[model samples]
Each structure stands twice: as C-alpha cells, then as structure tokens.
Target chain A: MRRIKCTVQYDGTWYAGYQVQPNSKTIQGEIEKVLEKIHGKPIRISASGRTDAGVHAIGQVFHFDTDTKFPVEKWLPIFNSQLPNDIVVNHVEEVAGSFHSRFGSIEKEYQYKVYRGPHKSPFLIHHAYHVPHSLSVQKMEEASRYLLGTHDFTSFCSAKTEVEDKVRTIFTISMEEEENMLTFSLVGNGFLYNMVRIIIGVLIEVGQGKRAPIEVKEILEAKDRRAGGKTAPAQGLYLYRVKYSNDN
Target chain B: MRRIKCTVQYDGTWYAGYQVQPNSKTIQGEIEKVLEKIHGKPIRISASGRTDAGVHAIGQVFHFDTDTKFPVEKWLPIFNSQLPNDIVVNHVEEVAGSFHSRFGSIEKEYQYKVYRGPHKSPFLIHHAYHVPHSLSVQKMEEASRYLLGTHDFTSFCSAKTEVEDKVRTIFTISMEEEENMLTFSLVGNGFLYNMVRIIIGVLIEVGQGKRAPIEVKEILEAKDRRAGGKTAPAQGLYLYRVKYSNDN
Candidate 1:
C-alpha cells in the first residue's frame, strides 16, 4: 500500500464542513467519495483539521492509502474531474507509510478577514465580512500580542466545544491592514472548537475600541466564555495551512 | 417622486446577469420584483451597464423613481430586508432628477483578476481565475499599455455584439501584481461588448509569452473579431464601479 498525500483548496461556502456528517455534503466527504471511485476501493482520508460550516480552506492537507499502481500526476486530474468545481486538488505526492496528515500536523494557521469600508466589494463579499465601523489596527495588534503564548483558551472557545484540555500553544498572532481590509493570522499547535472565531471576536472589539487591549489578557486568564466577545461569523475565517516537519 | 441611486453588490453566482430576462432569475428581476411588492407599483431600474452571466459587481449604480416618499437613510435596510442574501443593497441616496444611472455616467472602471500560484486559494476561488502556470506580469502590463487612449475596439468586441459603435475611449489602463494575484484595472468612458474581456484574453497571451506586446497594437488595428484573443471568462471579471462626480 502506498500513502498518498494531497493538498486541497476549496470554497467551503456550500459545504456543511470538513468532516462527514449524516446526509450532508462536506469537503472531505466529497473528495473521499471521488477518491474511492478512482482507486476502485474504499479510501478513507485523514485531514489536518476540521473546519466549521461555511468556512474555507486553502492549503488543507489530507492523506489516503491506495493499492493502485497509478502515479501522482494521474491522481490529481482524475480525482478533480470527478469532484465538483468548488473543491480543487492542488498538488498530490507519494509519501512514506508513516505519513498521516492529521497526526503529523505541527502548526496550523487560520486567517479571519474583514473589509472596513463604506461599500462591500462585490467580488469578495462572500470571503470577507463587511465592517461599517472603523478599526484601530494599532490597537488590534496590541491586543493580538496578548495571545502570542501558550494558554488555556477556554474563555475564547465556543460554548459548544467538547475539548477538555484547552491549553494550546499559539506560535504567532499577527494582524495586517492593507487598504480597507484587515486580516488576523493566528498560528497555533492546535485549535479547539470555535477557538479562532471567538478570538477574532475579541480582536474585532479591540480594533473597534469597544474592548481595550488589556481585555484580551483578562479574557484568557478568566477561563470563562463570558469573558470574550461573541463568536465571529464563520465565513470570514479560512484554514490557511498546516505544517509538518521532515521527519514526520 | 424621488429618484434614488443605490450602490449594489452581488455574488452573481446565482444570478443570470444584471438584466431582467424571460424565464431567468436575474439580479434586476429579483430586485425589481422585491421593489414592486414594497412600493405597490411596478419599478424598473436603470443600471450603469449590463454585467454578463456570473460576473460580479461591487459598486453597480442603479436608479429608480419612486412615488412613495421613503427616506434615503432607511432605503438600504428596507430593500436589503427583501433582497436575497446573495444580492445586497450596500448604500442608497437621493440623486437629482437629471442624474441618470446609465446615461449620466462619466467614466467606468472594471477589474479582471487572475491568480498564478502553485496552490489555488479557496477563499478567492469564486472571484479569480487560477492559472497555475507562471506568468510575466511585465509582459501583461506592456501589452495592456497598447490598449490605453482612444481606439476603435471592433476587434476586441464580441462577435455577437449588437452595438454598432465600436469606438470607445480607454482613459487609463493600469496593471499591478501582488504576490500570486495579477489584477488589471481598466477605466474607460465607455466599453464595447466584451471589450474588457477580450483585452484580458490578449493580455493573458502576452503574460504567457504566447504573444508579443507589439502584436496587441496590430490586433487593435485589425478591427476584426478574429484579430484579438478569445474572450476572458466571465467569473474572473468584475464591474468594480460606475463613476458620477456628484455621488463620490
């Protein structure tokens, strides 16, 4: 058996989410069904992480085992031909048997995009949130800095979360503003349920001057959901990438 | 009666186009039907230009005369409450009687976005065309420069074009690239049918080293449909804005 790792990019607007659900269309489920047909056998895929409904993914990594003798180049075009236009296979490569996409993931990064302007862009309306109010980028950066270390982010997690250990190591937290768009990029070892969205909600409040930079630190220490702002909308967030070391 | 000019934004993925057509779910038809229900009178809107099927618009200006004296401040919220989530009324304001959305336009601008990257961006999948091959941005820019200024763009016009006058004034043609995304911003007094799309087709050829920049001038001079490259896909193009000096 050969372990095949593939990088996929998909517009999650129509998908229920990354994981398979009962009678629901999902990004991973669609791709896996197509892969099963191509391989002429049942192929289960392991993804780097799961994204909520209406979210997007850029460099999402997945791996599956196949007994077929087909080459890497053939898998992409063949698999993509069967999949819908919304989901696309970017690259496919053969890796060692030990290469498990989810288990091997080290750091994952996500970006929450917001467009601050009088008018929402027709072109990017679905991909970003339209914020009528102005945001202080400097203040947002200061608030983001409070989230740059390892902490139990229970307060910033969604109430629906089932994860018991909320202690996750955040490698970097950066906010960038270009013209009318402001983006928050967060890299962490792992994210709990709705963690990124909740963090973004607090950051947006900081940017809007509704919450001070000090509130971010207080929210993390509180370990209570009420300490943070409401969960930001899901469509504004995107699973950017998943990193893996060479040994893995 | 009051004439209100509204700046509209739409995803266009579900829309047939901007115009109302028989047996078609169009942007105009959708908005008009909603207005007719709200106003208790048939309402027709005049738009700056007709966007092709699946082509999105950010600042698409449209005007309609209403007998009911509805305040401009509540116009957007009220109209948006009726409009589908795919189509949104971003802003609305009262315009002078002489201000016609289609006829009073001084200049119009469009943006055609193309992305050349190893991985397709899931977030940008709907808005931009993903061309995996590496492209020469300088070449595309050089070819685009030939399109600036007054020109008889008959060759660039669609073969099925209905407009007799192919002569149009291209005021500015600026091409800029950031990272993997290449954007062409074209501002013109008026456009021939499929003019911007065909221009982008030729520009893409230049970027791919398939055609020379000097060939662009020859294509324009030919004044025949076969002279220019194929029309660019509609999904990659967006009607960015329609300009009227008073509104901005």
Candidate 2:
C-alpha cells in the first residue's frame, strides 16, 4: 500500500462543503465515489481542512491510501475524468505514511475578499462581498493587530464548536485594497470555527466608526460569543492554503 | 427622452447571453425589464456587445432610452433591487443622444482563462476550461502578432455569423500567466460571432505545435470556415471592457 497526497482546487458554490456527511451531496462524497469506481474498492480520503458550505479553496491538500500501483502520471487525467466540473485534482505525489494532512499541518491561511465601492457587480457577486461605503482602512488595521499573537480566541470562535481549547496562535493578519477589491489574509497555527469571518465582522465595524480600534482588546478579553465581531458571509471566505512540513 | 449610458456586469452562466431572444433570458432583457418596472414606462437597453453563452462581463457598456428624469444615483439600488443576483448595474450616467452602445464603441476587450496543470478541478467546472498540458507561451505570442491590425477575420469568425464585412482591426492580443492559470486578453475594434473563441482555439493550436505562428495570416485571408480553428468553449470567455471616445 502507498500513501498518495493530492493538491485540489474547488469552486465550492454548489457544494455542501468539503466534508462527507451521510446522504449529503458534498465535495468529499463526490471525489470518494469517483475514487471507489477507479479503485473498485471503497477508499476514504483525508483532507487538510473541512471547509464549511459555500467556502472556496484554491490549494487544498488531501491524502488517501491506495493499494494499486498505477504510474504517477496516470493519476491526474484518470481522477479528473471522474470528478465533477466544479472540482479538480491539481497535483498528485507519493508521501510518507506518517504524514497526516490535518495534524501535521503547521499553518493555515485564509483570505476574505470585499468589493468596497458604491457600484454592485454581477461578476464579483459569487467571489466577493460588496460593501457600498467608505471604510477606514487604518482603523481596521489597528484592530487586526491585536489578533497577531497567541490568544484565547473564545470570543471570536463559533459558539457551537466542540473544541475544548479556545487558545490558538495567529501568525499574521494583513489587509490590502486594490481598485474595487479589498483582501484580508490571515495566517494561523489553527483556527476555531468561524474565526476569520467573525474577525472581519468586527474589523468592519471598527472601520465604519461604530467600534473603537482598541475595543478589539476588550472583546478578546470578554471570552463571550457576542463580544468580538459579526461573522462575515460565507461567500467571501477562501481557504488560501494549508502548509505541512516535508519531514512530517 | 434621455439616453442613459450604464456600465453593467454579469455572470453569463445562467442566461443565454447578452441578447434578447424569444423564450430566452439575457442580460439586456433583464435590465430593460427592471428599468420598465422602476419608471413605469417602456424601455429597451442596448449593450455594446452581444456576448455568447457563459461568457462573463466586468465593464459592459450599455445605453437605454428613458422618459423619466429620475436621478442616476437612484437607479443603482432600484434597478439592483429588481435585477437578479448574477447581474449588476455598476454605473448609470446621462449620455448624448448620438451615443449608441454598439455603433459608437471604438474598442472591445475580452479575456479567456484556462487552467493548465496535470489535474482539472470540479468547483470551477462552470467557469474555466481545464487543460492538463504545458503550452508554449512564446509560440502563442508570436502567432498573436499576426492577428494585429486590419484584416479579414472571416476564418476566425464562426460559420454561423451573418455580418456583411469580415474585416476588423485587432489592437492587441496578449497573454498573461500566474501559476496554473493562463489568461488571453484580446482588444479590438469589434468582433464577429465566436471570433474570440476561434482566435483562442487557433492560438492554442499554435502553442501546442499543431500549427505555425505565420499560419494566422493565412487563416485570416482564407475567409473560409474550414481554414481556421474550432470555437473555444463558452465558459472561459469574459467581456472585460468596451470603450468609446468622448465627443465622437
């Protein structure tokens, strides 16, 4: 048996997200069904992240154990032929069996896109959230800085999450604007449920003058679900990358 | 009556294209219906180009005749309230009576995005074409030069086209690549039916060594349907912009 790692890209629009739930049409279920057909055996694939519904991914990583010894080159075309149009297998490589996509991941990066202009766009409706107002970038940046280090992010995480530890390390969070688009990239050792979206929601409030930049600290210390920020919409969230070390 | 020039954006995935047809939904028709409802008058919108099915647009110029003197700023929210989520009315402004979206347009630009790698994706299935081979960019650029300037583009136009003159001027044809995504931007005075698609198809052939760079001129002069390449798939094309000179 050999472990094969794959880098995947998906337009998560019509999907029920990346996880496989019983009797649900999902990204994993779609790929798993196709893989079963190819291997003529049931195969369970493990992924770097289990993205929520309507969230997109450009460089998601996953791994599967296969008994077949097909040439490396044959994996792509054959896998793509069976996958749906909204998802594709971008790369395939042999990896060590000890490598675990989720636990071994050293960092995860996410990006939130905003079309901040008075004009609405049909083209960007699916890819970005349109905010037809003047937002203070300086305020947002100031508020985001408080999230750069390790902290107990209970106030920012989704209240429904089952994780026991609320403390996580955020490596960096930076926001930039170009023409009609504003992008926010967040890098972290790990993220709690709805963390990025909730952070953006609060930052937007700060940018709009409704909240003070220093209030970010108050919210972080509140340790309450409603203390941080509003959750940004799902459409604007993209799982940019999941990084795993080679030695793993 | 006032002639209003509006910049529009739309995801052509859901509609038949930009033109109105019996039993079909189109970007123009959808906007016209919205305007009629807002003003309680008969209105017809004319677009700068009639994009084919699944071809998106970012800055598609359009004009509509209206009797109501409603403020232009009000048009954004009112029309957007009535328009579908896939279509956006970005800007609306008063224009001279002489202006026509199609006839007065001096330049039109289009972009085609193709994803090239060993694997294809499922999520972007409806938006881009998956090509799993490396393309020679140098050859494509070399052949694109042959497309510049005035020429009879009958070979590049679709056989279904009904235009009397096949000659058109191409201002620029350039290629840009980022990682696994490759984009072809073609800016020209005008285009025939399926012209951009055919040009991309021919360029792809040239990039793959299936044809030579100089063969583009031969294809243009042939004025025969069998002389050129196949029409690219509709999903990969985008109507980026259409331009008009002031005081024209």
Candidate 3:
C-alpha cells in the first residue's frame, strides 16, 4: 500500500462543506465516491482542514492510502474526469506512509476578498462579499498589524471551538486593494475555527471608522470570544495554500 | 412621459435568454416584472438586441417609457434593489423620446473569452469557454483580417435568422491574451443572429490549424450558412457595449 497526497481546488458555493454528511452534497463525499469506484472498495481520505459552506479553496491538500495497481501519474486525469466540475485534482504524488495531511503541515495561507463597488457586480455575486460603503484601507492595515505574531486567538475564533489550546502563531498579515476589490492574505502555523473571518470583521469595522485601530490589541488581550466583532460572511474566504515541511 | 434608458449587466447562466417568452425566465422578463411592480401597470422595454440562452452582457442598453414621479437620480438604486443579484442596473438616464435603444444605436461591441487552462476552473465555469487544446492566437489574428470590412455576412449568421439584410460592416477585431484567457473583441455597425459566435468559431478553427486563414474569404463569398464553421458556445460571448448617436 502507498500513501498519496493530492492538491485540490474547488468552488464551495454548492457544497455543504469539505466533510461528508448524509443527505447533503460535499466535496469529500464526491471525491470518496470516485475513489471507491476506482479501487473497488471503500477508501478514506484525510484533509488538511474543514472549510465551511460557501468558502472556496485554491490549494487544499489531502492524503489517501490505496493498494490499487493504477500508475500514480494517471491519477490526476482519472480523478478529474470522474469528479464534478467544481472540484479539480490539481496535482498528485506519493508520500511517506506516516505523513499526515493535518498534522504534518508547516504553514497555511488564506485570502478573503471584499468588493467595494457601489453597485454589486453580477460576476462577483458568489465570489466576493459586497460592502457598498467606502472603507479606509490604511486604517485596516493598521488594525491588521496588531493581529500579527503569536497569541491566544480565542477572541478571534468561533465560540464553539473545542480545542483547549487557542494559541496560534500568525507569521504575516497583508492587505491589498485593486480594482475596487480588497484582499486580505494571512499566513500562520495554524488557525482556529472562524478565526480569520472574525479578524476581518473587526478590521472592516476599523476601516469604516466604527472601531479604533488600537482596539484590536485590547480585543486580543481580552482573550474572549465576545470581544471580537461579528464574523464575516463565508463566501469571501478562500483556502489559498497549504505548506508542508517535506515540500511535496 | 419620460423615456428612461439604463445600462444593464447580467450573468446569463440562470436565464433562458434576453427576450420575453411565455414560460421562460429571461433578462427582459425580469426587468419588465420590476418595472411593472414599480409602475403598478404593465411596461415594455426595447433593448439594443436579443442575446441567446447562456449569453452574458456587460453594457446591454434598454429603454422604457414611464409616467411615474420617481426622480431620475433615484432610479439606479431603486431598480438595483428590486432586481436579483445576477442582474445589475449600472446607469440610468433620461433620454429623448425618439431615441430608440435598438434603432438609434450606431455601433455595438462584443467580446468572447476562451480559457486555455489545462484543467477546468470552477470559478470560470459560467464565465468563459474552456479550450484545453493549444491554440495559435497569431493564426486566429491572421484569419480575422479577412472579416474586417463591410460585407454580406450571410455565411456567418445563424440559419434561423429572420432578417433579410445580411450586410454589415465590422469596424475592428482585436485579440488580447492575458494570463490563460484569450479575449476577442469585435466592433461592428450591427450583428445578425449568432454572427459574432459564428465568426469566433471560424477563427478558432484557424487557430487550431483545421482551416487556412484565407478560407474566411471563401466562406464570406459563399454567402451560405453551411460554408461557415460551428457556432461558438454562448457563454463565452458578451455584449460588451452599445453606442448611440446622441450619447445619452
């Protein structure tokens, strides 16, 4: 048996999420169904993490073990042909048996898009979160600086998070605006559930002058979920990339 | 009565077409429904032209006569609020009563997008036509030169077209490649039913080396629908702009 790691890209608009759930369409359910057809048996796969519904992914990594005789090179085309259009298998490779998709990761990058056009664009309906009001990107950048570095991100994560250790190291947080679209890129060793969205919600409030840029520091010190602002909508979030130490 | 002209943009993936049919969801049907709701009576709109099913538009112009007291400045926000997310009323203006959206137009520009990515992109599934095969844009440009003048375009239109006059002047044809997307822009005095799509089909054939660049001359001289190649898919085509003489 050989363990295989594959990179996937998907538009999560129609998916219930990445995980398999009965009576609902999911990215994992569709992928495993295709894998079962290929291997003639049930096959389980492990993903880097779960994304909520309406969140997109450009490079989400997953690993699965299979004992089939199919050549590794042909896996890309074979999986793409059978899977739906929304999910694409970008690259495939053989990995060590002990390499875990979730645990062996070094860093992950995520992006959130916000459309600031006065009128909502039909082309961006499912791809971006529309904010008609004007925003100060400079103020947003100032607020984002306070979110960089290692800290307990309990205030920025969902209240339902079960993990006792809320500490995570955020290496970088950058913001760019082009053509009425604001994109926020965050790289970190790990992120708590809904952490990025909650951070974005607070930064947007800062940009709008509703909250001071210095308020971010106080929110992080509070270390409570109630200190954070509302969570941003799911559509604008994208799982941009996942990095592993082996560089595969 | 005031004649209100509006520039509309839409993603045509969910609509049957631009025309009003008995039992179909169309761009015109939706606009008319909103107009009726605002006016408390039936209202008909005249558009620059009709777009086939799955065809998109960026600057489709339409005009309707209304006796309502709503200020002209308020029409943009009012119409946008009532329309669905897939359709946006970009701009609204008060035009001369005699200025017809269809007849007063001096020029129209259309764009066709071809995605050259090896794997289908879920984000562009409804926005562009995916052509995985390698295409020579230089060869396509060579072929398009033969079509850049006033000529009898009977061979480049749909066989089901009802118009008797097939003569039209193509002012320009430009091709641009950025990233993995190739966009073809055409400016003409007018286009017959599916004329732009048929021309794109022939040009794509030239790009693929299936036909010589000079064959376009023969096809145009034939004046027969069977002489031209297939019609390109509607999704890649967009009515990018419509120009009028008065410039309202």
Candidate 4:
C-alpha cells in the first residue's frame, strides 16, 4: 500500500459541499466514486478541509491510501477522464505513508473575490460577489491588519460548527484591486468554519464607512458570532492553496 | 417612438442560440419575453448578427423601437432586472430612428480563447477550448497575416449558411498569449457565418505544425468550404466589441 496526495480543482456551483452526506452530491463523493471504479473496491480519502457549497477551489489537497499497483503518473489522466466537467485532478504523487493532508499541513490560503460594478457581469455572476458601491481598499487593508496574528476567532466562526477550539493563527492578509474587481487573500495556519467570510464581511463594512477600522479589535475580543459583520456569500470564496512543512 | 440601442452580454451555455425559435430558449427569445412583459405587447428587436449555440458575447449590440417614452438611462437597469442571470443588458442609448444595429455597424471584433495544457481547467471549461498540445503562437501569428485584408472568404464560411455574398475585409488579426492561455483577436468589417471559428481552426492547425504558415494562401484562393480547416468549437468564441462610424 502507498499513500498518494492529489491536487484538486473544482467549480463548486452544483456541489453540496466537499464532504459526503446522505441524499446529496459532494466533491468527496465524486472523487470516491471514481476511485471505487478504478480500484474495484471502496476507498476513502482525506482532504485538507471542507468547503461549503458554492465555494470554489484552485489547489485543494487530498490524500488516500491505495493498494492498486498502477503507475503513479497515470492517476491524473485516469481520474480526470472519469470526473465531471466541473472537477479536475491536476497532479498526483506518492507521498510518505504518514503524510496527512489535513493534520500534516503547515498553512492554507484562501481568496475572496468581489465585483464592485453597479451592474453585475453575467460572466462573473457565478464566481464573484457583486457589490454595487465603491469599496475603499485602503480602509479594508487597515481593518485586515487587526485580523492578522494569533487569536481566538470565535466571533468570526459559524455557530453551526461544533468544533470547540476556535483559536487560529493568521499570518498575512492582502487586498488588491484592479478595475472593479477586488480580491482578498488570507494566509494562515488554519481557518475556523466561516472565519474568512466573516472577516471579509467586517472589512467591507469598514471600507463602506459603516464600521470603524479600529472596531475590529473590539469585535475579536467579544468572542461572539454576532460581534462580527455578516458572513460573505460562499460563491465569492475559494480554497487558494495549501502548504506542507516538508516542502522543498 | 424612440429607437433604443443596447449593448448586451451573455453566457450562451444554456441557450440554443441568439435568434428566436419556436420551441427553443435563445438570447433573443429571453430579451423579447422581458420586453413584452414591460410593454404589455409584442416588441421585435434587431441585433448586429446572430451567434450560434454555445457562443458568448461581451459587446453584442441591438436596436428596438419602443413607444412607452421611458427614459433611456433606465433601460439598462429595467431590462437587466427582468433578464436571466446568464444574460445582461450592459448599456442603453437612444439612437437615430434610421440607425440600425446591423446596417449602421462599421466593424466588429471577435476573440477566440484556447487553453493549452495537459489537464483541463474546471473554471475555463465553459469559456475556452482545451488543447492538450503545446501550441506555437509565432506560427499562428504568421499564418494569421494571410487572412488580413479584403478577400472572398468563401472557404472559411459554413456550408449551411445561405448567404451568397462572402467577401469581407479583415482589418487585423492579433495573437496574445499568457501562461498556457492563447487568445486570437480578429477585427473585421463583418463576418460570414462561422467565419471567425473557421479561421481559428486553420490557425490552430498551423500552430500545431500540421500545416505550414504559407498554406493559408492556397486555402483562401481555393474558395471552397473543404479547402479550409474544420470549424473550431463555438464555446471558445466571443463577440468582443462592435464599432459604428457615426458620431457619438
């Protein structure tokens, strides 16, 4: 048996989410179905984390143990051929048996895209959140600094999540704007459920002058979900990249 | 009555085509349905041209006559609110009664997007043509020059088209590449049915080294549909812009 790691990309528009659930189609379900067809048996895989419905991913990582003796290079073409149009297997490699995609990872990066035009673009409707008002990127950057570093992100997490440990370390937050498109990139050791979206929602309010940039410190101290701004829509979020500690 | 002109954008994946048909959903059909709802009667509109199924448009122009005396600036928001998510009315203006969207147009620009990578991208599946081979953009650029200037482009048109006049002037053909994505932009006085796609098919053959750059002259001189390469897929094509000679 060998442990294999795969880089996955998907358009999450039609998926229920990343995890398998009864009576719902999911990214994990789709990947497992393809693996089951190839191995002639059930195979379970572990991903870096779960993404909600309507959230896309560019470099989602997953690992699984397989007994099949097929050459490692054939995995990408084989899986991509069986996958649906909205999902693709980009790269695959045999890794150390103990390399866990979730627990062994050092950092994860996510991006949230926003279109700030008064009229929403037809092509961007599925990929970006539309904000008709002009956003102040400078103000948003100021607010984002308050979110950097280690903290208990309970105020930014979803109450629906049962995980009790809300502490996470954020290393960097960057915002770049071109034309009417604004993109926010957040890098951290890990993210709580809905933490990135909630952080963006608060920054947007600050950019719009509805909330002061300095108020984010007070919100983090509150440790309540209601203390932060509304969660941004899932369609605007993406799992950008994942980093492992043993990388070259 | 006011002669209203509008710029349109649409993702053509869900529609049959741009023209109206008896039992098919189309860009024209959707727009007319929304206009009929607003006017409480039937209204006909004329577009610059019809785009085939799975073809997208970023700056499609159309003109229609309306008697409601509604403000021109309100037309875009009103039409967009009534249209589907895949279609949008980008801009609206009141044009001269004699100005026609098709007849008054002096130029049109179309773009063809190609993704050159071994693995298909999920996000670009609906928007670009996936070619797994490494393409030579320099060869394609050299071959494109043969297509410039006025010519009888009968060989580069669809056999199914009933239009007898196939002479059209290509003002420019430009090739731009970024990473593994290649875009071909062609500006012409107008296009025959399937002209842009057919030209791309020939250029792709040149890029792949299946045909020499100089062979394009012989193909154009043949004036037969079989002389040129196969028509490229419709999903890779986009009507990028339209131009009119009259004063703004």
- DockQ, all models: 0.46, 0.66, 0.89, 0.88
Candidate 4 local lDDT, A1-248, one digit each (tens): 99999999999999999999989999999999999999899999999999999999999999999998989998998898899989998989999998999999999999999999878888888899998887788988988898899999999999998999999999999988888899999999999999999999999999899999999999999999989889999999999999999876
TM, chain A, every candidate: 0.95, 0.96, 0.98, 0.98
TM-score of each: 0.90, 0.91, 0.98, 0.99
Residue A70 Cα positional deviation in candidate 3, in Å, after optimal superposition: 0.6
> Model 3, residue B222: what's the lDDT?
100
lDDT of 3 by residue, B106-195 (tens): 999999999999888888888898998989999899999999999999999999989999999999999999999999999999999999
**Best of the two (1, 4) by TM-score:** 4
Question: What root-mean-square deviation over C-alphas does model 4 reach?
Answer: 0.9
Weakest 10 consecutive residues of candidate 1 chain A by summed lDDT: A117-126
Candidate closest to the true structure, highest lDDT = 3
Candidate scoring better on DockQ of 1 and 4 = 4
lDDT of 1 by residue, B173-231 (tens): 88778888888899999887889899988888888899999999999999998988888
The models' CA-based lDDT, in order, is 0.86, 0.86, 0.94, 0.93
Clashes of each: 0, 11, 0, 0
Evaluated at residue B42, the lDDT of candidate 2 is 67
lDDT, candidate 1, at A40: 75
Pairs in clash, predicted candidate 1: none
Q: Which stretches of candidate 4 lie over 4 Å from their true place?
A: none
